[model samples]
Target: MAMGKTPGNRDDEGDEGVFAEINITPLTDIFLVLLIIFMVTSTVIVQQGPGGGAKAGLKVNLPKGGATDVTARSTDLSVAVLADGRYVLSGNVVTTDELKAAFDKARTENPETLVIVQADEGVPHGTVVQVMELAKKAGLAQLAIGVRDGE
Candidate 1:
């Protein structure tokens, strides 16, 4: 007989009707937890360097080294050996002949220019050596093999 009360329900006993409003406390808690998880994961990813601090278009798993960081000038040259048997001089893809030409040009401008060779872990030893030999032939006296920190 009471308004919003089911039939046969006793009026003497005070009983609230079915709850029409949704309880958002648990939903809000779940969302907050997910947000916290995303925040932590994103920070971790940002802190970790790609390829151990060597940023290049080509993916190269550099060998680990115990050597400390050496000072490099802005004019220093970087050569990357790709996994597909290709070469990257500075940031451009080039053939062996083209690489040699670039090296020659760089040497002409700066004879003491340092050449840093970065080769992927799966790259053949012969390929790396050939690159080094080309650098030497190009008149570059200072050559350094790039590697990730051992730590």
Candidate 2:
């Protein structure tokens, strides 16, 4: 209140002077209330689980097409998009004309076949698109593009 009074000098006589120090009781009370509130709400947040983050809306699903005669190994077939917009399926460099034959033949064997495309990074974007279009037209539903992983 008044630093321990002035020794023998009684400024307020029997009365104690007003407290000049900040009363931290109210601050401590408020912080404790906030801490408890956060503790309760944090569990709710944790229970809600994690989301896909910024790519949440970018989720894509592979197509589910009709069952075919192709084996599961067909899923490992190579798809390459050439710089000249050629579609290569399983080592057979194909023009647009041969895509249907290759694709249908693959699909007719493996029902779970997926076409994963690996093209030169320097290749034209249209070439990649052409490969995807060809895969779709060939009755192969799942098309995944190969890319180098980032650091």
Candidate 3:
């Protein structure tokens, strides 16, 4: 009889607002574990440097038979062919287009620059020719090859 609503019927907003609070304990634990792992791996990261990750301050004293007077010459460029025909030049694995670009840059710097090629022994000779051809196309005419000395 009263003007107020009936007891059974309720307003639409009777319940409190919906909420979602993420539990951060597990997340914090994961972050801490990752930090520890990185700290443990820092020693390995020290091995990388500009000289291509080569080790320094360590030497091996091996028995030497004799020394030869083959003077070491400077290289202006290099190329390589893997047994699977992978092509690499100037320390970078590159496509034919990239190889050409590198050769052009190297040749432009020094017209008489030497181009040294190092290929896997298992690779076919023809594959090496293809790399050399790319070098020639980019104006690198003076090319040298590296080989193993007889033991």
Candidate whose TM-score is highest: 1
- Candidate 1 segments whose C-alpha is farther than 4 A from its true place: 1-63
lDDT of each: 0.81, 0.68, 0.69
Lowest summed lDDT over 10 consecutive residues: which window, candidate 1? Answer: 49-58
- What are the per-residue Cα lDDT tens digits for candidate 1 across 34-60? 999999887666557565332433465
Residue pairs in clash, model 3: none
Clash count for candidate 1 is 0
Tens-place lDDT digits, model 3, residues 1-151 = 1243444556765553333445688899999999999976764564553332445325444333232423235646767777888877656678878877888888888877777777887998788888888788888888766665545
Question: What TM-score, to 2 decimals, does candidate 2 have?
Answer: 0.45
Cα lDDT over the full model 1: 0.81
TM-score of each: 0.55, 0.45, 0.49
Error (Å) of candidate 1 at residue 40 is 59
Tens digit of lDDT per residue, candidate 2, span 6-112? Answer: 44555776754455566689899999999999987876665554453444445565344333523335255567777666677667777777776777878888755
Give candidate 3 regions above 4 Å deviation.
1-75
Error of 2 at 56 (Å): 20
